[model samples]
Target: MSPSFCVCRVRVSTGHCTRCARCASSASRCTRLPDPELERGVRAAHVLRRLGSDFVVFAEPHLKASNMKNLLQKDEKKEEPEQTVPCDHKTASRCLLNLMPVVSETVSGTLLNGTFLPDICLEVVHDRELSKLPFAKSNLTVVLFADISGDAIFCIWKADDKSTLADTIQTVVDCSLNIQKNYGEWPTCIGVTLRVKIGIATGMLEYHFFNDDFDNVHYSASGTVVEYVRNAEMLCTAGDIILTTEAWNFLEQKGVHTRYTYTALPEDMVKVLCFDPSVTEEEKVSFTSAFAGVRPALYALNFEDAPLLKRFISPVVVNIKTQEELIFLSEMRHVTIVFICMPEFIDIDLATLSQLYRIISAALKETDGVLNKVITFDKGCSFLAVFGLPGYKGKNETCNALMCCNKLVHEISAMNM
Candidate 1:
């Protein structure tokens, strides 16, 4: 028999059961108590009969009452509401919903301690001349940093009259892809959005550097320049580049002629006006001097290296071919020295050899010598040095190399030059 069906003894006294209301209403005798061992059987039979009656009650229309209570509990949970997440331009523009994988990959490796986005925004603004009147362009470069979920939006004016907004965005996408291909690995999570906002303004390039830490700093642009750009973007329609009156006036003063309406503010409305002629002049001189100095040095480096030279130089001021030729011509008057060292072959001291290698390496670095070759053999002969490289700015790499090479040459000349 099943464990639940095991039989047990039960005693019943009908005379005593009729005196108790609970027992009298029952069909079975209920007044007699069995021994503790047999009580289990009595309770089981009573429970079965009560359950049968309960089952019948549950089958009636009132069964829905329990179900309705559960549903009401569920409804209360539903009515409790959910929290909304804050949105940002970065998330809004380049989210997976508008995923542009190529753009994301392009800016992924940019070193941003929170400053790359702002710089990129300024670059886009500068490139498009958004500060100019009638703003004629509506292109933007969006840079998103995944770690901080921060975004930077840059708008360009007058990219192409024939292109649609989508085409302009695609152009930015293509540019970003090219950047990634040329510059090595970028952050996989970094994203880009294009042509999302149009901005135009005319103002001085105000500079500020944000200190991420003692070792990290990022440059930013702000002041009236930022405000006007944001205002212009707000006033602009989708795919339209807009400019503020201040930006238009600034462009006019800069000799940029454009037809655009302007609204003059009351003199009292102006809050701040500060000018620094020294700063502007300093910036002009610095840029001019840097280009003047670097151009000549770059030309010389390219000229001496020729076919093997392309890898080391950057493409600026001219195309690779012209730059190479210019550098080659500049090397016509330059001289190159090669130093090779040979130590004694007798005892063959490995410690001395290691020390000598370290010395040569340090001399090369100190002299700014780009070590082009190193060849050593079993005879204790070492060939090391550089050729056709720029002098170290102040590190004295050339002098250091010459001094070290001379010492080694004097020591080894008796054995072998």
Candidate 2:
């Protein structure tokens, strides 16, 4: 079973309450007492009935139905601004100046501390300019993490396909450099000092999407490679592509080293090497093997056939309808983050999964919450929701988060699947 929990200041388990002082205050709001055996029986019956009938018919109508809007709460407060407040772009930029570093430290503390297998991973760092780039494809899996103000995007390429790992690495590098070069040419970006940090690491990852609806697709990756590449990107300097030792070694082994010019970093600065003993001796043999590197500009990089890369770029930017929306996302504000995990979600049917996504998205929209990120792995899926961000009903963030979670739990339970 998934360990259901809520995060205010700290994690508070909703299913099994420890009743510690910190979580005790919110205990009543967080806890959900559902009979597991009964839930399983009902869910099994529902699945069996749907399987007996044409489930597609049931799923299709609900997906296109206008009644999904009715699921949202009607009585939203009118006082809050419907649009993002106008602020100097410079001021907005400063609000997020310290954002990336803080995000990197948190990721390091949580996900990157584990040991794992090495595989090639690439990152493209960009400001809002590269938002619409199609980076997802069949062989590539995109995982998105929303760090309140921005997203931490990672793309992992599956090795089972015909394309060589070298192809994956080079393509990502080429595309990233191309993006940076284009941004450099933009008149507004010339003196602004905006930089994109693309990090590449070689490590293990796994992913699969529930359906073909790419717009509604919630694709994510799991395992060490995701963490490794994320850390690599976060540690990277602006305007440079950083590579973990594993990625570097893989490239050299493939004899693709001559294509790009790269300088190795000092041993102390090579963070991937310091991780648990997964680092092989040969991978550490050369000082010039792994580090920040520059590549020749490829102005005409095309995405016509790169579906995996397209997936990588999808969730990084979505649903931004205005410049005000962009500015709003840039502002730093205290918000409550609610993380929802369904450990046994792998057993749920794809139709149900899609339905769940829509339900959650609509719930957050109605409650003045932002559905920040959705992470799917082999066993289950998790969602990140934020409350009290600008351009929404800004009052009572913590209360809103709890109420939304509670509502979701009940609504999802009623789905009985």
Candidate 3:
């Protein structure tokens, strides 16, 4: 009744797919043949069996699986005309617009040729991973393009925004994990594994344009940075998130700690080291325990829109408020805990207090030499600020904490002025 196609019984990792049969696959995951003979044989066998014929049927050859279905349903965003990649023969172009929605603009107030160049670019190379196409439409990733005409997929991001960068990375990682998690849920997954090669690079990059005029734009990324990202992607193993040195350095400087070493990539490449984001579970548990799945359920009635929830896990940095929470962090010693209590005599209103507290918390996050996590608390008339918790041992941790403290003081003073 449905479209009949043989789901190739082949294992897949990255772009490499094991052949169910040489003739069955050239570059595709699996090819189905018009088995009129098999179909006729089966029908005839059914008739024979009804007539009590002993003729047996080998079910193996006929029971092939189907490919993943299209999941990129234009979510209920009808108010905004269902935007799509242009497919034109006249004045229009074939470029995939809106992938990196926030393409950089020049000082001249004109959009550059294709789109504004963003700070970070991530390429996802996948085979039998067609399901992830839906996530590409999730707004976090600018779905550049994906086609059987091309070898893999291209997704870009505006990496300079620290929160955007973190969210983008988290989304991409979630995509990879979901692909694997939901693998066996579909019939086709038994025949293939969704393998992904992720290459993340950061720099002043303008993901160029591909239009009807530039017929040659589809060959591959021509720019040096783009080429380097592609090369890094190729070097990635299955499900690896490899970052170029520049990108890795930028994140590391921001206090994202991961145990990595330098590996001189090929001359044709761009990064000094290939840093992998897939750290051990033990390594992640320490900091992640602080907020893993700890967020409260958000609803449309309570929040503005879904995009608002995109704020990265850096919620107002404050420790949990219970005795258990305090005990949990009690053993965390030598930590620079600075308590900024407003002078007891000066009564601060709740509204003003909230604003000042957030400003101070943000200062800690933005301060250089400060580590990633800065736990803060709103203990009534005064606020408690703590730094140098586990996972952050920067030699200048205390000094940086003091810097944040001074920044907080200056900002609060300016606020009053």
Best by TM-score: 2
Worst 10 residues of 1 by lDDT: 55-64
Q: After superposition, which runs of candidate 2 have C-alpha atoms over 4 Å from their true positions?
A: 7-76, 80-85, 90-137, 140-164, 167-250, 256-335, 342-355, 362-368, 377-380, 388-391, 394-397, 410-417
Better of 1 and 2 by lDDT: 2
- For all predicted structures, in order, the TM-scores are 0.20, 0.39, 0.26
lDDT of 3: 0.29
> What is the per-residue lDDT of model 3 for residues 236-336, given as tens digits with 9 covering 90 to 100?
66545455665555445655434333454553322223234564541111111111011111100121221111111122112222222111211212335
lDDT of 1 by residue, 41-99 (tens): 22222222221111001100110100111111122323323222211222212212211
Output the TM-score of candidate 2.
0.39
Q: How many residue pairs clash in each candidate?
A: 15, 13, 7
lDDT of 2 at 20: 10
Residue runs of model 3 more than 4 Å from their true location after superposition = 1-151, 160-190, 207-222, 259-417
Q: Ranking by lDDT, best first?
A: 2, 3, 1
